[model samples]
Structure formats: C-alpha cells, structure tokens
Target: MSMKTRTVKVGPVMMGGGWPVSIQTMWKSPLAAFSGPGDPSLLAAADEIRRLAALGCDVLRFAVPDETGADSLGALAAASPIPLVADIHFDWRLALRCMDYPIAKIRVNPGNIGARWKVAEVVAKAKDKGVSLRIGVNAGSLPEDLRGMEDRAAACVAAAEREVAAFEELGFQDVVVSMKMNEPGEVERANRLFAAKYDYPLHLGVTEAGPLIAGIARNTAALVPLLKDGIGATIRVSLSDSMESEVIAGREIVACAGIKKAGVRIVSCPRCGRDSFDTHAFLARWSGRLYALKDTLEVAIMGCVVNGPGEARHADIGITGAGDFVLIFIKGEIARRAPLEEADKAFAEELDRLLG
Candidate 1:
C-alpha cells in the first residue's frame, strides 16, 4: 500500500513521494521566556534537540504563541542540526517572524489562522522561504458551520479540504494536512477520507492522546493502519508523557506497521517471580542510549537465564542474571560475567564491542 505522494523537503529531510515516513515530536518546554542567541535556555534546547534527533526524531516542532516565542524559536532554529517547525495559531505574523529564521515549516489551523488572506500571507512567506505548511485540522475545533455535522470525521476532512483549497487558491502547494481527533477511530477515518481525495502529504497523529500507556495505545491504533495503507508521510505520537517517549513510540509504531524497519529494537522481558536482573531499571537507564544508536540491531534485556541466552539467542547483544552473577552474551554465547553491582559497566563495555 505504499503510494506515491508529493514530497515536501524540510531542511535536511524530505517527506512523501515514496520517501521513508518520518518520526516527529513537539518540544515540551516553553520558549517564550527565553530570547536571543546568548540565552542558556535556547542552548539547552539546542542540546536536547540534538539528543532527540539522535533518538530518531526527524523533525521537531515548537509552539509559537507570540512574538517572544517566535524570537526564541528563531534563534534556536538557527543553531539546530535538524529542521524545526513553528506551530502557530491565530497570529500569521508569528509565522512570518519564524520564517525570518531557518524554520522549516509552519503548522496552522485554517479556522484559527483567521481570514483567507491571513493564510495567504503565511503561504506566500512559506513559498518565498521554501518553507512548508501543515494544515492542522483538529476535531475539537471544526468550522462553525461544520460543528453541527454528526460525522466528526467528515467534518475534520471537510475542514482540511477547505484549508487545502485555500492554500492552492493562493498558488501555494507546499502543504501537509493533519486531521486529529481524540478518538483513534475518528482520526483514522478522517485521514483515510482525506488521503483518498488529496495528494498532499499528511502528518498523522491522534490529538490529546493521554499519558504514556493510553497515548501510545491510541496513537498506535490510529497510525499503524494508516501507515500500512500508505496514508501518512510523517507521524507524531502525541502524549502527555515525555517527548522521548513520543519519539520512541513513533519509531515503534512505524516499524510495527512494516512501513519502515530500521532502528535499534529492544526485546526486554517483563520480570516475574523468578526474576533476578532488574529489567525495568536497566531498560529505563539505557533505553535512550540504545535507541540513539544508528545500527539496526536487537538488544535484549532479560531478567534471568531462562529469558536471556536461550530465549533471545538471535539478539545481537543480551544480558541476564543467573544465581549470583550477571551474564552478558553476544548471539547466545556468554562473553562476559559480572556481579550484580558491576553489571552496568560490564554491559556497557560489551555493548560497545558488539556495536563495533
């Protein structure tokens, strides 16, 4: 079901036109308070952006509510290695200001961005700057006329259609559309509807998706089917949890859909009564680092011998516990042994050797 779509380049990455579907996450911090190139907050954000990019987030978005947000995000975008998107609502001026920097895209709700001319203003700037736009149509905020429609999914698609028309009318076609709803079914229905009619690349997501467990469940349910259908060009698993969780979950969802399958896959066992190694603690400590690796490898973090060497024999690297010793193995062969206290350091060294 991998279909061709019009490609939109965002800085170093390209979306659609049979390109690999990208993973994205919103920056959780508020940038309005930080201003200028010298601000420490922006520097910290830049460092975090690098870390997120390393963790497989292809694009990063920040909410630009006012001029101050635009000011800070502009400075940060100048230094960011990966492309940055300015999520602007209401004010088209902020989009203009954000475009003053190297921001790659602007996300706007046609309903919120006001008149057709306002959108045109943004679109004109977007075209001039070689920037892209995402027509963000959320279920919570359909048009005034469409609000009374019984079918929420149809209303979302209609809103997106209207926005897409608005952009094309202005002769600006570098567009991506998203029709998000809290319910996974509604989101999927809207995206499927839009994908059937339009060639614009879609930014797939479920909005206001709850915390870690609920968010991943909802986003996965909605995105997987759409990805397999070749309906999405990029995906963001919006969550009430950390941004890292969102990016990691997005990667897993894309892989699960069989759309794209190149990343560090973790095969960790859930500890039980016979558990020895603390799988939970180890995974928490190493998850980010493992995910940041560029190699396509399976790393198994198991609790005991039963779940480790024998069960995860195909894994590129693995660790488990037996009686009084923690064992590190490569492809089912025990390569290093350490006491429980020294497992972390020993596993780190073994992982380096394995990856090398």
Candidate 2:
C-alpha cells in the first residue's frame, strides 16, 4: 500500500500524493567550484546534470555556502534539464537569494537559520516565488535544546515538527520534510515517526552513509522497509561517490522496494568455480549503459550455462559463457553465439535490436 501524502511540485516533477518515488542526488562539489558568475563551467555542469537526469535523477541539489555559490547555481538552474534544489545552511539570506533564481526548491534547517523571524523571511520569499521548501533535519545537526533528548529519532522528529509548525504559522505550506540519521536503525525510526505524525511528503535518506558500497548497503537497509510500507515520497542514496553512482543506487533501492517497475532490471549470478565468464568485469562495463536504458526489460548476465539459462528463462534477454564462446539467448532461445572478444559488441547489437 502506497502512503498517501500531499503532493509538492518541483518544477516539472511531482512527488508524493501517490506519485512514483523519485530519485535525487546532491552535487558532489560546491557550486562555486564549478564556475564563476559567467563561466563555461556552468555549461559543463549543465551537461553533467543532463547525463544524471538521463540516468533517472529526478532532482539535483547543490550546497550554497554563500552569495557567490547561490549566483552560480542560479545560472545553472536556468539551463539544467531537471529540477534544481539549493541546499542552504546558517544563512537565511542565501535561501532568500536562491529563491530569486529559477531553482525549484530550497532546503534549510530552521534550527540553524537563526531565529523564527529569519525563517519567516525565507518562508515569505519561498511562498511569494511559489517555490517549495524542504525542512531537512539531521541527527548530527539537531537543535541545542533537543540534543539532550534520550531518543535520537524522536529528537529528529521534534526538530522537523518545529520547523513545519513555523512554516504553517506563516501560511506557507508548500513544504517537504526529511529526517536523516547515519545509523540504519535510527534513520528508519526517525522517518517512521515523522511519517506517522505528518502527511507532508517525506524525502528519505541516510546521511553520511559512507562510500559507494557501504553507503548503498546502509541506505538500502534503512529505506527498504519504509519504502515498502509506502512511507517515502522521494529518496537520495547519499554515497560519497559520483552523482551517477548515487542516482543508480537510489533507482536500485526503489526498484528493490517494488515502488518502481519501469526500467531495465539487471540480474547476474555470483561467479563460482563452475563459472567460465568474468561476470564482474562484464557487469562493470555494461551496468551504467544497461541501467540508463528506459525500456522495461530484464537482462541477465550469468557465469555459466548450468543454472543460467534455466533460472533466467523468463528473462527477455540473457548471456552466459559456454566453453570458449558466449551464448546470447532471447526469450529462452539461443539467438547468437560470439567469441569472448566479441561478446560486448554482440550484446550491444542484440540490445539495440531489442530496444528498437
């Protein structure tokens, strides 16, 4: 059962309100690092954003440390193909300045943005510009008053609640909420508590989730249950890696949770002594291109013919190493056979034909 919540539009994308769970990733570097006020670097960043969007990144966020960063992001936002989010901290003025641009969303912690009136000022501008606000609450950044709370998850919920109340009081309700904890258990607890208490869209993620492998593991453990129970509106797999990796992890998590069904699904067997193919290397070379495919198809990369063809017989397409050659199977029938060196090209040709 999908959790029902109010929808918040971020540019052309709609999340929550029974919408499909969307994937988001934060820019790995500061916006200022990308370009100056009027530099070609902005175009480079725009090109990268377009690539990430093709990989299924629904929203892209950048850290706005100061006015200069805000200005840089404003220019990128105008050219970006997907919705952009400005992540602001400490300075309410940055949030206000971000609103002046075409940025789709603003993320700020009410606790760090100074007093209530400062939040009100940002909220007023957000409302005036028709931009949605994401009240991000992290366990490491909880307010001083709430830091001593015995329940860390409860504390996160409280912090988010306080900020949401402030937004409501100002008659600004176009809001999204996120409560993140690095620990999987606490992350689940915090998001669960927030979901039970509020109907606002919940952006789910585990903060500081480490590098690619560990981050994917932690985020999957934390987000799977919540997503399966229909809790999250949007999700970001915060991997300390490339933005492409983060978006890929997010898409896999959503697909694993059964929240999303349209995309290429890759299934490969773990190679053992019975294997003849280098499953790992082949998958590594093709994973990105395979995932980027928009078609709803299952592609299996198996190590050997033993259980490969039988297990994935229902797959639309499959490949397995047999003897010194690779066998390409489509709909349970062998479609083509190619040597090891030509396997990739053979698979690509078959895939293109299937896609066409």
Global Cα RMSD, each model = 1.4, 1.7
lDDT agreement with native, every candidate: 0.88, 0.89
Task: Give a tens-digit lDDT track for model 1, residues 62-156.
Answer: 99988888888888889998999999888888998998988999899877877778888888888998998899998887778888999999999
- Measured against the true structure, the TM-scores of the candidates, in listed sequence, are 0.97, 0.96
TM-score of 1: 0.97
Model 2 has an lDDT value of: 0.89
Displacement of the residue 2 alpha carbon in candidate 1, Å: 5.2
Query: What are the runs in model 1 whose C-alpha is more than 4 Å off?
Result: 33-35
Residue 306 miss distance in model 2 (angstroms)? 1.5
Worst 10 residues of 1 by lDDT: 29-38
Cα-based lDDT at residue 98, candidate 2: 91
- Residue 157 of candidate 2: its Cα lDDT? 93
